[model samples]
Target: MAIVSEALTVEELYYNYPDGTAALRGLSFKLMPGESVALAGPNGSGKSTLLLHLNGLLRPSRGRIAVGGKPLDAAHQAFARRYVGLVFQNPEDQLFMPTVGEDVAFGPQNLGLAGEKLRERVRSVLDQVGLEPARFLERQSFNLSIGEKKRVALAGVLAMEPEVLVLDEPSAGLDPRSRRRLIRLLKDLPQTQLVATHDLDLALEICSRTLIVEQGRLVAEGPSEQILSDRVLLETHGLELPLCLMGRPDR
Candidate 1:
């Protein structure tokens, strides 16, 4: 089958941290609409750095990033933000309002939605994340469990109705049950997902394609099954094959 073009495209991307540490070098990829992909790699492998560039949090030190065929620019930054909603690795970083509903409402409100429409959007997104609208809406953000907070953060992003969802280490630090819940929720969502994670199991379950990076450069790109099944290649880049794939009967 021929590959469809992309809803978001990154070409020849290069970026360096303020301390002069290069994070991404000549990275290029395209995310087709409704496609799920995992960006897997080790620490300092530039996963977070790449996510930052997707929504214009960090402009490229070199090369270009385009959303829906329009190059990223000052005027188009707002449009890009609306199109690509980034859910940070830490829920605290993304959710700041006193109440869960307020936090979820922040993004839509900023987009100038108000009154009934804003309430409907907030309630709808919270429900979508499996958080009961009435029960969670008035609750304080700090009182919720880590998993609940993560879902709330996602609800906040979903409220924006983004075409592309960028997630950074979404399953990190969750208990088994919470992790399972998150995986199920992720699988159910209809939006295109660009997930940055070290969880190969989750990646295998939810993503069709995998991009492996090491030390600021993309080392592997292919179908998730092929990339994740190659134990030697994964080990070379300081990664591991998913346990289920390690002792497969066919292998």
Candidate 2:
């Protein structure tokens, strides 16, 4: 087998809140370019904390985190932000601009792209996410539906053209059709994706690898099939195995 190059790497990462309550405890993992990996865990399992560290939003209290082979710190934070595009679990948190176009253009504009190039980037991303550029460009974010808002949020991150896309619960509270559409869009994106979600079926459908986190610690890491099929392990970690794979003699 060929070795994949690392897009994100965490080395013994540990993080704590203001009150000194640790949220992440010595967690370590590597994300390769063009790879889609799912992060599965219950609430307060450090999933969000780990995601924040990928883009330098929250520095590790101990150990180190590197994005695209560079250390995540003040010196490399700007570079890390450009390389890692994070789509928040709530679209409301990500969409703050008066207009959808402006929100999508925010990242690229900050990066110094202007004129026709910036417009092209914004339009391209919006279209890629299944939003009609002409229709959404002038629309206010607050007026859009939940699904549209999610797409716009994704477009904003896509406009940045980051090497890695870190998504936190991308499929939360959406209708079945919307969920499927989002999953399809994610599957089609040509970027490395680290999806932190409670949707095991989504993970099994879209991710090649899986990482199980529990109580601020990583308990298991392996191919999605093996990890998802391990009923005992899943139950112990407060997770459930996908039904289709629950009882198959061949598996």
Candidate 3:
């Protein structure tokens, strides 16, 4: 039998800013293929910093990161992005194109796809995000609501057809209905997922495994149900248990 290659691997990663402020301290973890994992932590717990490393947006000051068993290096960064797609928490940061279709087409266009291929790619990703091609294609991105913008931003990344999807606080600033729809969409995707979020309920619903970080260190890592149920653990890391799980006996 063949062994399953890890989708992502980070070993003893350490990152420090120019001011000498350490953001990641010896952080290490592994994510398997087709797995959905949660990165749960308070603000400034290195969640965002760690995510930057996943797609080579930020280089590690020390240690190593491998995507599909290949080590991440300056030359290989572009290649890595082909397999690892990252979406920021704020849709506004990603949507600068005049039209929604243009934004979704950006990544593939950069990869040398054009004309009929590019149009089809844009149409397909819009459909994937629950946006009709004809209606949303020509729509001005800036005029859309926050929920619509988020979906459009996601469609842009999804068009890249990555093997692993890394999302930072995906459920942030979303309405209940939008949040539920986002959750359903994420659950349906076949790509390996690593989501950084403070929303315990979102983590519980979408991720099977949970890794908690605090003060740039991994505080806990385990099954989502096991980790989230421990009130003391959550409080220790400046987090609160989800209200829905608050009175449940299992929790």
How many steric clashes between backbone atoms does each model show? Answer: 0, 0, 0
Clashing residue pairs found in predicted model 1: none
Cα distance off (Å), candidate 2, residue 39: 0.3
Candidate 2 pairs with clashing backbones: none
lDDT tens string, model 3, 43-75? Answer: 888998999898898999999999988898987
- Using TM-score, rank the candidates from best to worst: 3, 1, 2
- Candidate 1 residue runs with Cα over 4 Å from true position: 1-5, 249-251
RMSD of 3: 1.6
The lDDT for every candidate, in the order shown, is 0.90, 0.90, 0.91
- For candidate 2, the lDDT comes to 0.90
lDDT ranking, high to low: 3, 1, 2
Tens-digit lDDT string for candidate 2 (1-251): 98665899998999999899899999999988889999999889999889988998887899998888888889998899999999888899889999999999988999999999999999998877778899999999999998789889988998988999999998887778778888898898889999999999999999999999998899999999889888888999999888667677854
Model 1 lDDT tens row, 136-207:
999999889888888899889989989899999888877787688778988988989999998999999999
RMSD of each: 2.1, 2.2, 1.6
Write the number of the candidate with greater TM-score, choosing between 2 and 3. Answer: 3
Deviating ranges (above 4 Å) for candidate 2: 1-5, 246-251
Q: After superposition, how far is residue 156 of candidate 3 from its true place, in Å?
A: 0.3
